[model samples]
Target: MTFDSLGNLYGTTYEGGGEKSEGGGTVYKLSPGSSGWTETVVDHFLPTGQYGVAPLGEVSFDPHGNLYSTTSLGALGVGTVLEISVNGQSRIFSFDRVDGAVPAAGVLVDARTKTLYGTTTGNIYNHGNVFRIAASGQETVLYDFCQQPNCTDGSAPFSGLISDEAGNLYGTTEFGGANGLGVVFEVTP
Candidate 1:
């Protein structure tokens, strides 16, 4: 769960919805009311939609207050990057092996530019990649794992990224350092 600038709490559940509703999951909002905190289901990911299901990360907001996140699984057999707003929910990007697949991390929105950065756990490399998707639907692969012949650089980034003032990104890989252990890496986009 994460809080917006307004102090409202937002999150997704891997389960729960109305009777007869497909069990993809639900997006919830908790508002601070005079009595206490009240919860509301803002949206539901039904198992039947062309869209995705099985969200597994914290929600993050862009500068304009739209929320962004990823689901671990979806109907297409690949996960997705989803955006939510008062207007409703939308799928910003769908994962496919050519570009990338299986996002293990949620999105990190550049508050100033609205570009999104995240990691995918599979690719032709079978190691993973770091990618950037713009609000305009363009996806850029910033780094492909196992770039080094033996993947000495790193592999399978299973977490989100941190941005520096100079426009650099830092993240961790689940495996592949000089010693075949996990590693922390920095990339400039």
Candidate 2:
């Protein structure tokens, strides 16, 4: 889910609508209706192998009002980052997995830098990784898990991240940490 600059709410669903898995997901906008709340599915995920399936996680918006999110299992068996235009045009960020795989978190786009940050569940290691997807679609790994004892730093970020004004990222771990009770971490760019 996400909030726009004017505080409008938007979101995407992974599954469970009338169109079934073939429909993939729905991009929605939320607003206050006369009765209470109203939601509209701005776009429906097409049943195509090229487009990723089951979009998941919180959403983010670009300055132009495009929304972004990720999918886990997709037509390629990897994953994808997608942009939904305010007018409802869908565009794939389009990065192949030489860099990583199976993205499970919403993208954090640093609009000032035109760079995007995300995490992926990789093929070789289920441990997952944080990666950078450039505006030009070049992908790079920022961190990988060793999967040893304490995980030393932290492991498996299952949610979206928050960045400070200084360009530092703060997030949580779902598993594998010092006390095995999960962890909170700061990543400096």
Candidate 3:
């Protein structure tokens, strides 16, 4: 989960809500209450087909208070980037093999540029990749894992990224490296 400036925690579930459950998942908020912390569902997800299933990471936010995230497997049977506001959800990009698929982690937004960055574990090479999506919804791949012989660079990043003041991205991989133990990496745009 990720915290907003106001101290509210935002996150997603892979499945289940309550006895009122529709069996997909939910976007929720946790805030400090008089007694303790309180959790409330902002919305629920559909099981499949265009709506996205199995949310995999913390919900990200823009400066305007809108929430953003991804479904590990989306309606098209790939994955999708989602932009959620009080108004509801908007599909930012549907993951297809051609564009990258099954984003396994959360997105990092550059407030200065309003751009979105994330990683996908599914691709032609089945490694992983770092991608940038602009404010207008344009996408560009910054790096694909396992590009070198024996995958000396790395593969399958399972965490979100952190960016520096210079706008470089940093993260880690679950596997692949000279010793096959994983790697910490950086990408400069």
Candidate 4:
């Protein structure tokens, strides 16, 4: 699902309303109603692996009203990020390891530069990396962890990051810090 400009919500449920996981998914819309709020299931998964498995990530809308998101499992266990248009048209983006395999979090789009950034659960150099996936789908490693003694700079950033108005990126570590209880830090471009 995706978010409209006014903050109304839309999303999907992979299973449970009927035949379990094989029945595909359900597209839903959540919006403020006069008395309260309402939910509508707009579509359902088709039981074909090509359409995807559970929808496990956040959804974002492009300026042209196309919705985009990824599922943790689908299309051969490697996962996929797909685009769903307002006319109900959907297609996979042909994502693979070069885009930082297994993205476990949502993508952050840099508004000014139109760059897409996300982190992965996969590891390189014994730890995960912060990655930037450009509009052209070329991904670059911005930082790799466990490079320092005691990893004072932080390690294993499990969640993704956000950049402030000044263009500083902020994120957290699941391990390795002053006291090892986890820490939140920022990076400057």
- Which candidate tops TM-score? 3
lDDT of each: 0.83, 0.71, 0.85, 0.62
TM-score rank, highest first? 3, 1, 2, 4
| TM-score of structure candidate 2 | 0.85
Those runs of model 4 whose alpha carbons end farther than 4 Å from true positions after fitting are: 1-3, 11-18, 23-27, 41-48, 87-99, 124-126
Lowest-scoring 10 consecutive residues by lDDT in candidate 1? 14-23
Give the range where candidate 3 is weakest over 10 consecutive residues by summed lDDT. 16-25
Rank candidates, lDDT, best first: 3, 1, 2, 4
The residue-by-residue lDDT of candidate 2 on 1-189, one tens digit each, is: 777776568888876444544567766778866698777777666657466767777788777777777877565667788777756545555445655677777889898876888776553566667777777767777776545676755666776777899988777767767777557767675
Model 4: which residue pairs collide?
A: 24-45, 25-45
Model 2 pairs whose backbones collide:
1-58, 1-59
Residue-level lDDT of model 3, residues 14-77, one tens digit each, is: 8876445555677899999799999999877877547687788778888898899888886777
Looking at model 3, residue 68 earns an lDDT score of: 90
State the local distance difference test value for candidate 1: 0.83
User: What TM-score does model 4 achieve against the real structure?
Assistant: 0.71
The digit string of per-residue lDDT tens for model 1 on 56-112 reads 767888877888878767855678888888888788888877778888778889988
Runs in model 2 with CA error above 4 Å?
A: 17-21, 47-49, 87-98, 147-150
- Give the Å error, residue 131, model 2: 1.1
